[model samples]
Target: MNRSVPMNKAEDISRTWLEDFAQLLTKTENVEEGVTKTFLPDGWLRDLLIFTWDNRSLNGLRKIACYLQENLPRSVISNIELDHHSELAPKYLPLNDTLKCVCSGFKFSTTVANGHGFFRLVEEGPGCWKAATVFIMADSLKGHEELGYELGVYGGHTLSWTDVQAERRKSVEVDPYVLIIGGGQTGLNIGARFRQMKIPALIIEQNNRIGDNWRKRYPTLTLHTPRSYSPMLYQPFPKNWPLYSPRDKIADWLEQYASSQDLTAWTNARAEPIPVYDSKAKRWSVTIIHDGTSIELHPVHIVVATGMLGIPRVPSPTDQNIFKGVVFHASKYEGGKLFSGKRAIIVGAGNTSADICQDLVFHGASSVTMIQRSSTCIVASSTTRDDLLRGWPEGGSVDIADLKAAAIPFLYLKKVLTEHAEEAIAKEKELHDMLRKGGLNVSFGTGGSGCFPLVFEKAGNYWLDVGCAELIGSGRVKVKHGVEIAKFIEDSVIFTDGTSLKADLVVFATGYHTMHDGLKTLFGAEIMDQTGPIWGVDEEGEARGCYRPSGHPGLWFGAGDFYYSRFYSKQLALIIKAIQIGLV
Candidate 1:
């Protein structure tokens, strides 16, 4: 094989390889063997509702073979053509500036829908360039492709935008095909996707405003992720947007997002405490209450995007009945200035606790103490943005960034990030040493992944250091580790280790139950038990019970960060559309 030309021009090599690969896929007998030869020994294949109406990641020969053997006969992937668009042209993209991959995009079609994909290949040896990862994402179903933005009128001044909007609102309000229960980023993104796919969806927000979920949090709160990494559907922040947006700024963006998308949303509306599902009709009977009036509606699908957890898990102290100072869950505690000139004791050392501690120090709290029941995973905000958000470059298209991030399977990414986390700690040894010297317990993340995979795991147990770590390291805030709260008194709080701290305000930053557990009241214990696990990863490291079939007809769950919501919302929409149309 001639290697000099291939080495000199990665694009030419990729073009030739893709042509052969497309031809290889035509013959059934050669397809499996071709995949084995083309991909690395531990290559990854991430499928977002292309092969089937589900999100899946395949690694190694066994999973790939089994998946293809089961679904390939039915999926009948065909019309594999390489894309020649300038933006998607074959090029050498670097991974962490260490490994080079010749990447190219392609267009294809499955039995159910049409799709596009990107393949990243690396030079394995002298003449072998093997695929490191291949990502296939569904673009549209055969008949349910997202409609273009076209004026309703062919010849102008006759159509009223207001009337059209009202008609759409009434149609969905009367009998929505999908009902989303929260108006936060997750719910908003899901509703936006449904809107684009022409699905009748109504978003019920319990708060008085669409963005209140973010606005109600403590002031001075800012997002830890970079601006390029945090964006709503279809809209990128202006070039002048801040690197780290404040909470209120984000809240305003969410409020604007719903309006811009023209989504049907009801603020200050709550679905009934419990919904009754009619199995025969395949619909859920729910009532939305606004102010005092109630309206009955029957939606075929119900998406519980309220949160990862709805109920707060505040601890009950034994002696709280005897004497008490001001005590409340962290959610209820508005701001640190409210507790000015008063001693504060906060239980838990996760993100919320860290934020509260930092807020109190900035404000005039007489003293602040944090009770860390267990060690915490800590990484600087800047380090996290650089380490986890490398794919999301400044002034780049978010679509490409999302595709690149989703290319690697979760389990493989977890292993890679763990190594990066270890390197991060070693590099920031001075900061960690000071934090330990000041008595704050720290864990580098679950399995030492630097808390990158925790979003797919427990969702808590980590803090992205903003300014609180510096304050803690400098002894501005006191830390009490390895002790649980024994009881609370009128003037002081006692610990199980027989230590007591004088306190005027106590805040429980303790986390809540798992998302599935939070649904017991709304879904009832029986149905909740039957549903699949909501947030954590399953054996294959794919997110369970979210953006996929929830183990029950007409029920779905939407959860995760902005990045998670942005990409998976489409996955959720595609599967739901397939189900509704009887195409799956």
Candidate 2:
């Protein structure tokens, strides 16, 4: 058997595999037998095809076999067809350093919905292939498809567009199906999803503007991810747009996105009274205060789309009243320009602290010092961007790109990456050398998996260096590692090692508390206590307490950066839509 011969027959090979697999599924007398014949010995399945009615990522044939026993045979999926698009075609893919497999894609349908599937095949012997990983995702529900193009008001309409808009608004004002709190990217994106699905959702934002979440950030702040990596729902940034958009520009885009998407949102609004969920009716009766008027609304679902972090966490040192310099948490940090000609100290060694240190030096601060409580994982921005988004192709169809990304289960990716961790750490020899020379302790993260896992485990434990390392290496910025802040004197910040650093201003660049505490404040201990863990990976490797369930009924949590907010919020919209139509 010639090794290169399969390249010519890749299509036929994949087609045959699909035909046989589809028949194998229908003839499944037993779920265990089905898994044995169709999947690899160590197979993986990322099932979101509504058979689970929830998202699940299973590793190994044993786990997949057990899950199939619970959710299959009743699914009745059919209409399997090959998808030969450039991105989803059968080709040899280097899944990781240790494994290379032939990846192919297909489309399928269930009784009430449509879905896409991708399988990575491993050649067991000559003319033999078995699926190493299988991913199934529901694309849309039947009879509830969204109109892709705009439905303009033509000549034969009785009501003007404004009147029609008002009528549609009035209908939801009476009773909305979903109530979204906090109009950040997550809230805004979710609202768009509901509108397109014809599900009534109302967003209440405490801020005065739709994009105030971005506007209120530090003046020097900018999104490091490229524009293409984090597109808005139904809108991509202009081609000439900056790769790294400034804060003010992003704020404007978000404000325009809400208007163009026809999202029903109320700025300067908040849930006045704690929502009371009526189990009998399966609705939450809550009052919202909008600019001075209080309105009552009963919504079947309440989505808390607050920003990733809840409350700003500041350290409380003993005898802090003696300090005179300006002190604030990173959340309240205005801008470093105000500290020009002054000495500045930034506490904590996460991304926030690194940015502040850079900002302080750039703003002509006489001296800038960083205090590190623990070692931090740092990677080059270019390397991190490419590695995290390798599944996505530049300037291609995002739908296909996103699905390809979704096919890799986070847990499976983490395990493989960890096994290949030394390879990642090896490529950063120069960056680590510069950091060590700058007197800052560095790490490739726990288990030497580098910084990827820390993104979810402790979102603030790493920084993607964008010129910060050079500044620290050149001595433009100073670093103090492995020490905790002890106290503050009138002229200097005292450290646990009895050393002190004098500064005119100090900022604690420490991270914030998770949404659990803030939700507890909004919904009370009863609702909070019942909720599952928020902002971390679960046993199945999916993010916990969000885009799925939070334990309490009629409550959901939506959050993450632009990419995550889009991908996961879309999934949340599907789950909610399914629940609304009695599918789950």
Candidate 3:
């Protein structure tokens, strides 16, 4: 029997990594140890420290080694060794105390890409022994800078730090370090798309690799929506290919796209930005700490393309710690290679939950059960496939916006009419329905909610909400109402109905809580003013979800809401271009 490594329950594994490797900074000398450390000069000492990690997977160790050797100056990274026997163990160690004494400013680096790489002190005398580890220190401003480096959307640009305060004149700063936070489809697309536009962005992912999440998906997962309209910029999904690409197929395409574009440099760089608003300069001072050194950037504008799927939420509340078989968010799900013969339960009613169930079953899960709190409009892949396979003509390509624009004239004409046509029509419908019930009239007119969705007098109330109602009636899926999960009990979930389901694996395909907790802290009261009732129904009253924070300026969401439509990305790209040219 194979035993797994005892892992922390938290999704963000980097937090634990920082704690474990904090010891390595003990031997290294700080560039300047004052209350402020953000102004440290950028040089060989700063550059010599090559920090890396395996953000993609446990296998990212090799990729980090290759990245360091390829990108950094020669002789900086040496004596690389891999030990397979030491699985889940720290591979590198400090050299000796003697060498440490000679090297006063000796430094160590940690890999943010994956939690594997560590710094070492090499001493070659009297049987060299490993010495103390160094800890990288970050003061307030410095901490913010480091955060910005890892999480900042904009790439680094060259602008004198002090000169910004000295002069308020708008001057363009040339791009230097381009940081892209997300490693998802949009993030990858932005990097690829912008690189073609001649701005090379250094993409940083919290995960291990470019497409690890996609590759680990269940076998049955396929693109439910139209694929022809959905694709990375410039690179179209090949024609004659299947209308619905499997999960792995999309993953493979992303990896290939990156490889082809020579974006391997972005593989292990997990940068977080610490943004400081310079009141004097009227610009944000963003600092990014990579490995162990700070690289401050003054960007004219920042693009936050962090995708939606980062944060996972549970719908109906259940204390996860109570039962403790094996629980994880969809983001952390690797393949079910180890789950053969085990029963699994997937919760939630979205595409993610659907994929999870399909994947678990394919992985040899003994039994897989899905629990949904509400009915979803379950349109099959057939409609989506047909749409993609049969391309629409130019006239048909007019989007929802175009249709709405055309409806403006009709609305004006309706307003001008003094005959009370709408009220008359309502009266006629009521009278006709009353007569029809009495067997006096037998005319079937397609009366609806008077609008697209709200009307349904002629077709009957059943057809009004037929989509959702039928899905519940369909025996293909299990339906539950007033779902109240009591607790998780010993490889099973107990419901408020006093019913318990045996489960080997219970997945919360639950919805996602807003991933803007970090942003909330950063923006403070401004965030509340910007988001404007976060969980409320009137989402679009502001800027399409979370975009209104800056009055529709500065804030750029890559995958704000995935269901918005394919044109949303194209619109985003166009906005970015306009911003670049000062059009927006």
Candidate 4:
């Protein structure tokens, strides 16, 4: 018997062994041929790879297999050793006298490359072992470079690069294969994926500039999630960027992403009427108002990336004509300075409600009160970063985290999250006690599924307490829980409990309508009803109406935060591409 190898030596041996395995995979007729049954045993990778590929359809898998075969190294690059610092490292099983290793690395060539590989191996007997599973990245073998000779010096060329760009910009009437509505994070992400797949796509934004959606938010707003959890596809934020990026910084990043990725977005353009889909031709004829001029486009597909919460849902309070105070939705609340020395009443108790209340307090509002229509799931921001997002730590690969997340079915994920939430709540008992004692309404969320599930299912039921919970606990921000607005009087709002409070400004943080409701004007009630509800877990445990087909032909919905968009954009692009190529 031999003693377990040192960590460094174990890593080296694993790397060399995996490289050999990679070479063996290249020589096989098919990448999946004889790899799993012969080398790897039944395990996580086996289940995930086979399930994903099989579910994607054999035709789709064949296309992917061809791509892998074309770019996988016929032999290992001798000069360049595999990246050993990958998250997967060999572990010593002393009790079993075995070494288990799971590893991944990338191999690049001049024109094409193998992007990533996931491998699992265990010591079968002494010096000999077999791979349990191996998953490799498929690369489309194509060169990505601009064709030119000193701008205008080439043969048959008369225009400079700038002139060419201007000409291209002028020709906006041309037909595109895919038309994406909303140039926000989701839109830009899918657009970038389409660009990589060589699929022609155009994004139409209602705002004059890209990222105005983020820019229009409150002045003190910053991303609640970490930078690693919220990155655009292909391009991540610079290393020096704040962990929680400010709103404007993110806005600027979106603008730069769209430009750098060369995504064709028509800003200040909006779809005028409901798009008419031709079932027979599998195309969408959309009329968009661009700079006050209507342009008709017949695109093969129309992706509604207008976000999960597209329309601000402002409840029309009765007796509105009597109230004299300023009234607006949370979306219209840009800053607190405007409400200085004024009593503010924010309706609803969610993340936005909490943030707005904190902002009003900071900006010297005379009195701020949060009306809690329902209990909110409250977790500390630190808890979210350390526990909920432990999978996506700083410096970890976002793609890897995404892949790992996708591997787990949402049903099982919900169970896992529920258990995690229970443990998390117990761990932070002091915080929960403080919140409860301070008269703040808190819950562990629906079925104790915590933040992620709540976001996916309800979209506005949870709040990751940054500082507002403390403010509420300390009475800096008053909490009026378990109540509903009865009606508005001349200068105050009366609660259902017969309590009246004077308010100079009323902010409704009641949240937005569903994506389906938001599309009623453009898609019409009939078409929208056919499309089904926007966000929620479907029977398949996937996000309803996203990445998968909507009920209507040639219509799709892409909505989620940065991670969700980045992770699922490939599936959306592949589906679109498959349809275009007649595979699906």
Q: What does candidate 3's lDDT look like per residue over 540-562, in tens digits?
A: 11123322222323444555322
The order by descending lDDT is 1, 2, 4, 3
- Show where candidate 1 strays beyond 4 Å: 1-8, 85-87, 94-99, 152-155
lDDT of 4 by residue, 1-584 (tens): 55466566666656666666555444536565534322533322312111222222112233334434553444332222354445544533332334444344433332232234445455556665555444443322224221212334433676566676555445534978889999999999999898777678889999989989899998888888888888899897899999898999999999999998777899999997778888888788889899999889999988989898878888876897799999999998889988899999999989899899999999999999999877888888887777536778778888777764554455555765775665767876777787787787788876788777788878878888889877887888888888877889999998889998999999999998888888898989888888877888765456788877788888889998898889777767766765676645
Candidate lDDT scores, in order, read 0.83, 0.83, 0.40, 0.72
Candidate 4 contains a number of clashing pairs equal to 4
**Candidate 3: segments with Cα more than 4 A from true spot:** 1-179, 192-202, 216-219, 259-265, 279-282, 289-294, 315-324, 335-337, 362-364, 388-480, 521-553, 560-584
What digit string (tens of lDDT, one per residue) describes model 2 on residues 13-67?
7887787778755654676766777788877899874576678888887888777
Candidate 1 local lDDT, 1-584, one digit each (tens): 22233344877768777766665455456567877777788888788887667788889866675666666655577888777776567777666655667888888887778888888887788657888778889988887888768666633676587887888898988889999999999999999889999889999999999899989888877899999999888889988999999999999999999998999999999987678889999999888897678998899999999878668899887788655578889888689878889898889999999999999988889999889988988877777789556678887788777876877788988877776766767966876787798798888876678777887788888888888878888888899999988987778888999999998888999988788887887778877777889989988789999989898888899999898888889888998888788876
TM-score of each: 0.95, 0.96, 0.50, 0.79
Window of ten residues with lowest summed lDDT in model 4: 49-58
Candidate 1 C-alpha error for residue 415, in Å: 1.4
Better of 1 and 2 by TM-score: 2
Q: State the weakest 10-residue window (summed lDDT) of model 3.
A: 452-461
The alpha-carbon RMSD values of the candidates against the true structure, listed in the order shown, are 2.3, 1.9, 28.9, 6.8
* Clash count per candidate: 0, 0, 48, 4
Q: Which rank order by TM-score, best down to worst?
A: 2, 1, 4, 3
